[model samples]
Target: MIDGWYWKFIGVGLIIYSMIVGMLVPLKPSIELVAPSAAKTGQQINLEVTGYNTNYSGSASIRAWLKDEEGNAVLSKNVTVINAQNLVANFDIPGFLPSSDRVVPFTLILDHPVDGAMVSPDAVFITQDSISKVEGQTLWQKDIINDLTLNTAFTFPSMSLIRETIRNTFYHVPLWFAMVIIFGAAVYWSIKYLRNPQSYQYDNRAVGFTSVGILFGILGTVTGALWARFVWGSYWSWDIKQIVTAVALLIYMAYFILRNAIEDDDRKGRVAAVYNIFAFVALIPLIFVVPRMMDSLHPGNGGNPGLGANDLDNSMRMIFYPAIIGWIIIGLWLANVRYRLLDIKYNLMNK
Candidate 1:
């Protein structure tokens, strides 16, 4: 038994080793924001920007457009940058004229000079007033408008430690993946217990995996909390992602409570299994469905998908995948140990 457990430990170690090596590989891709932001009514705004190129030289230019709340184009021009190296562009919008309505929007464009190099994100113009007055004079041209053209070379931010930190992606995403797998196992054992009261192993499996899943779930939650606090600020906010995770944890807790409420070992397993299955069903909407529909502070919502093109770069993916596999294997090893202990304690008590 000792040798077998040692081999299992070695296997888990190897999986972790693979994850570390996998995350070290590098990848490069072009990433840029389409625009700075949307506009509202009653506000004057300036666009600002920065760019980075790792390999070669790159230049960027800005274009500006003014639109109504409905996005109908009102006026457009190319900004003349006073200083390209400074990378700043300023534009002025005249106050609402008799014909001009409320809530103006602005869009900025960033163009690149070189083929291989990518331009940084474009800036956006949003106004305070969303409502527009319909009966306004359409002007051929406005005198108050000033377009600024700026030239700026692209620059890359320091990403060496960040590149290696991509392993956290695996750490963040896959422990839940393994948790999903183990929770599924828990449900399976629950169903087996309900059908056959004589089969004690099924009950043992249900408890065993649920415990392991909770342990890893907590780890994933803590790691994610740290990551969010660093990148987003605040350790806990009722963000959709965080809220859903809390719900998932609560549902599992109810499962454990239901188990303890029952006195018969046989009955405890059977009832707990039933609750475990329901918890899995509840997990789907809490973790995946509801968060996607709402405006999330996290990336991947409001027309932005988190970790898509901009957030999790290719360099980060290398380490993340391996960390997931290693953690899941380790989770299973712990589950086995728990399952065997339960089996032994039951046998001795019955004898």
Candidate 2:
């Protein structure tokens, strides 16, 4: 006999822990060079570079160099750090060099007090008019080594479109996961009620779980819309996944309307139980299957992979997994409370 209070405490603790961890971590410094992929001989090339987490406000050294296949440095240039994360580098292409279609690789190196020495190898591509080969050369070694230490605070991944809204992953995604778990439990109790129509307890339990599941589903929709508003530039994108989820929720909504339309206890239990099973069945294809078959903006739709290397990384997985578990526990706690209340009300009515 596990008490409901146990789940309540656990759910609250996990939720709070996830919130703290999801917001505090910092990202490692990364560099992106905006240099041209091709340059002509006797041309002056200027490279624009952007940095993340580079601690650009302080004094930092930035350098770039072009390397040949033989690991010899063909051209070395000093980068002028405009700010912590921004820099400009200039290179002069020699007119005497021969032309080749092959691409030349360049490297960007940043040295910061806070982030230490960050090196981005083969960071840029340049198709120059030079076919001159440097042989018997060795690779250039980094002057500064990185100190791989973890920060105490939690940080979310800084994606291009999502930006800070990536934090919503801890909240929005978990609601749907929790809703699925809660609705699955409702389907189980509905099956139990159908097996023994006389047992009002199963009917009450099914109704309670369904009610809470629907609530979670509605919350999921609202949070998803809020997340979309920031990323997609609208609250609703008419995306296939979004539309299908709305239709599925509406189907579950009809389940409650059907339950209320009935007056007799036994008949109502039998009918609602049947409807609940059908609703869950319909939900499967609408939310999971249909979205995958069509083109959609949502991640994992139309054969697109969910949480790729660029999306959810190892740091995010740390909190995301716990968030799903925490919300599921919380949803169960809500359903259990609702069940007990309905039980008490019905017992009183019998007296």
Candidate 3:
């Protein structure tokens, strides 16, 4: 039986642990902003760098460089650490850009012994009259960027655009995962009820699973919307994933409405069971397959790399995978409680 208090304790404990780890842990040091984003060739430039989770003033051995797609780079002539999270980097722009393009953006890389290395891609664009690759090679290659030390900070990955919202991964993703599993269990019980038409217990269990799954689905949608607002600048962007997920949830909701429409216990159980099974079937394509086929800015969909990529590295996995496990356990426990309540209601109504 899943009624034991021990399982509840374990599930709640893991969930609390996951929440603490997910919220408390910091992201890796990063160059959050580089002001004066453009410069002309042969001009002296001093750009302000606003860093995130960095300690620029703590170390005097700081180095900065601007690099392009090619192997060439221009090292900063002066670096002034204004504070823990702000710095000024000055560079004497080379006479020519290293790239073949007339305009090319350069990445800013900053390294410190205490904070390790942090970068801002396409931080500054330098426009030149010509490519002058050969001449650039002579000028840009003078300062080697090999003196950098690897970052050993224990933190989450600093994803671009996503930034701090990347922490939402632990909650939002795991909730969806748990929802799918709970829905699968609901479908399983529905199948069992269809096989044994005489058992109201299976019907109650199916209802419990469906209700909890719907709750999970709602939470997942809310969390995802909050995450989307950070990266995409809106709560509802009419993205395919959002639309399809809403439709899928609505269809499951109709299942409960269908159950309410029928008053007879045997008939209600049979109809709801059949509808639950069908809803699960529809959910598969709506949530998984259709999202992959369309163009979406949603991470992990439409050929976009999911959490399995660099976004969810070993450090996050410590909180991420455990969160998934904890959510699933809690979902099951909730479903079990819901079914017991339904069973009690069934007995009370008959008595």
Which is the leading candidate under lDDT? 3
Report the Cα lDDT for candidate 3: 0.87
Query: How does each model score on TM-score?
Result: 0.61, 0.78, 0.96
Question: How well does candidate 1 match the true structure in TM-score terms?
Answer: 0.61
- Each candidate: RMSD: 8.5, 4.8, 1.6
Question: On residues 1-351, what C-alpha lDDT tens digit does candidate 3 reach at each position?
Answer: 454588777778888988998898888888888999999999999989999888899999799999988758888999999999999999999998766688889999998997788888999989998678788778888458877878876888886788888888888999989999999999999999999988788999999999999999999999888888878999999988889989999999999999999999899999999999899999998888887777887776335523436567888889888888899999989899899999899899989
Tell me the deviation in Å of residue 234 in model 1.
1.4
lDDT (Cα) of model 1: 0.59
lDDT of 2 by residue, 1-351 (tens): 146377778888888888988777666555544555556545677767677666555654444555444443434455576876777767665543322445666554445555554456665565644454331122233232244333333455555556567788888889888988889999999999999887888888899889988998899889889888888789998988789889999999998899889998789999999999999999987887777777777765345523445668778889988999999888888888888888898899889
List model 1 lDDT by residue over 185-228, tens digit each. Answer: 78888788889878887788788889998887888788888877
lDDT of each: 0.59, 0.72, 0.87
Model 2, stretches more than 4 Å misplaced? 31-42, 57-59, 65-76, 93-155
lDDT-wise, the better of 1 and 2 is 2
- Model 1, position 330, has a per-residue lDDT of 76
